[model samples]
Target chain A: MLDVFADYMTYQVFEITKGSKLGDAVNFFIYDSLKIFIMLAIIIFFVSIIRTYFPPERTKQLLSHKREFLGNILAALLGIVTPFCSCSAVPVFIGFVESGVPLGVTFSFLISSPMVNEVALVLLWGMFGWKIAMIYISTGVLVAIISGYIIGKFKLEHLVEEYVYQMKVGQNEIESMTVAARLQYAKDYTKEILRKVWLYVVIAISLGGFIHGYAPQDFLADYAGKDNLFAVPLAVLVGVPLYSNAAGVIPIVYALMEKGMSMGTVLAFMMSVTALSLPEMIILRNVLKPKLIAIFVSILVVAITLTGYMFNIVL
Target chain B: MMKIEILGMGCQKCSTLLETTKQAAEELGINAEFVKVENIKEIMKYGVMSTPALVVDGVVKVSGKVPNKEEIKALLNS
Candidate 1:
């Protein structure tokens, strides 16, 4: 049905030739925009409802005092369901620490929460096939667990700021809600997320449409192709400094993949941009010492780069 | 008289919560003292991991989201 509408809008309403580049771009944009918005609305609403059940406070309680490896695994998995925002990172970090959640476990949650988010998953599944999406999810969680475990093994607790250890966090009751309230919250949260991301999604898809129509085939293959050894690391390096939500980045990833950028390199780039950003580094610096931050970044960069290379070889 | 404390680390939602809570208090004709707790240490003292938490008379009423005006009014009344 959407394909028909896009065909009609491109061929009949616009009067562009059926096989023209402009027609192709416009058709791609219209179809993708409609499909993405629908997917985003439904996915975000359900994800928001699930989020209400796993507040950070409850997650803190669950993970506190667990052994390191198991805690890291649980934290990484729970990171997907827990509601988190960078703005709340400090309080959450402190809360985790004060509550005796292992630093490594906390890092696992931090790493996976932003990297394996619903928006990224939805966008990847929509743009790419479910197989690729599943690959991204599994690899993302693996990176989080391994990187966090490595950090824990390093025993870098002393690298945290002194104040984070000294701070005494009081306990507050989790807010309870009725079914109607949960539904309402989901509705409101979905609207809020859509309002925030719709513009970025449109802009990204527009750029993607342009690339899809105009960019010559195999343009990026030579530079960032599967055989290029530096491609994955370079992509991660470039992605870390730039901050963008998954909605804004996935369209570009689609365009890049279409233009012959290797799948692993593009995926790594997307993960780097979403998971390890300069602004988040600055925010984390408040709690983590410079040395710890550097180590964390290095570990993630290595882990993401390895995942990229692994995908390149396997897929 | 009521004391309403908005706990956050100065994020956008924190200010929005403050504005909505103040409006709710005014609509209810309740004399309220509003405090914006922006310090991380201060916010941690409340034990709320998520921000934009509403506290009435030092009791945490809500955390992690900005309730609508009607919801805020209900909270204030309660």
Candidate 2:
């Protein structure tokens, strides 16, 4: 229904404007904006409700003292629904540790929370179709699990700030919420998220529209082609410092893909941008020592790079 | 009058706890003060590990999970 509406509007505009540059830009913008916004609203609403079930407090309880492999998987999965903000990094870390959640399992949650979030999934699904979205989700979760397991193997718990280990928060009471309250929570969450990123979505879609209408078709393909060995790593490196959620970065991703940037490279870039950003790292630094942070970054970088190469090789 | 502190980051659970606690207090017709402690340092001071914790009169009552209104009422009375 949405696609048909978008297509009809674009078609009408193209005819009315005689297929001019303005027409093309307007068409691209209208189609992308309508599709993305609708998708965001619907997906975020459902995901928000799901999130109400898996708050950090609950996730900490589930993953605490869980065995290594199962813990990594569960943590990564929980990371999907757990609502985590950078500012809460310190307390959540302390909370998880005090509750016996392993450092590596916590890392899995942290990595996947940003990297494979609902926002990223919905945007990818809306713009790129489900095939690429599925691939991104699977690979993202896999990377989180593997990286966390690797970190766990190293037994780097001691590398956490000494203060985290020493601080103990005794168990507290768990609250049961009514369905109405849960719905209200979901409503508020969706509003908060949409309010934060609405402008970014508009800007991103507008840029995407401009690129779709005007940019040369072969720019990225010729330069950052799949055959280029350095393309994947370079994209990841560039993406790390540039902080943006999947929704905010979708316009660039769309433009790049249109320009023939390989899926592997784009996915790698997206992972690096969401999961390995500098600001998130600094926030985590309050809980993790420098050495542990370095290890985390290196593992993620290597894992994401490998994912990129695998995609380039296979698809 | 009673003092109630909801300790957690401003996540959904914390907000639920806040509302639930408020409702519990209102149903019981108890005059109470509700405070949301978002600062990590202050929350840690209470030795509350998980988020969405409840503190009554500066005593840690619950640490994690969003308890229902009935539980809140019991906690409030106790």
lDDT of each: 0.89, 0.83
Candidate with maximal DockQ:
1
**Candidate of highest TM-score:** 1
TM-score of chain A of 2: 0.92
Report the C-alpha displacement of residue B34, candidate 2, in angstroms.
12
Query: What is candidate 2's lDDT per residue for B1-78, written digit by digit as tens?
Result: 789999986767799899999999999999999899987767887756557778999888775567779988998998
Across A1-315, the per-residue lDDT of candidate 2 in tens digits comes to 765665677677445463677766766777777887888888899998988787677888899999998999999998888876665667778888888998889889889988898888877887778898999999999999999999999999888888777775655455677899789878877887888777877877776666654777878887788989999999998988787777777767877888889989998998999887787787778778899999998898899999999999999
Residue A82 in candidate 1 has what lDDT?
83
> Candidate 2: where is the Cα deviation over 4 Å?
A3-15, A18-21, B1-41, B46-78
* Whole-structure CA lDDT of model 1: 0.89
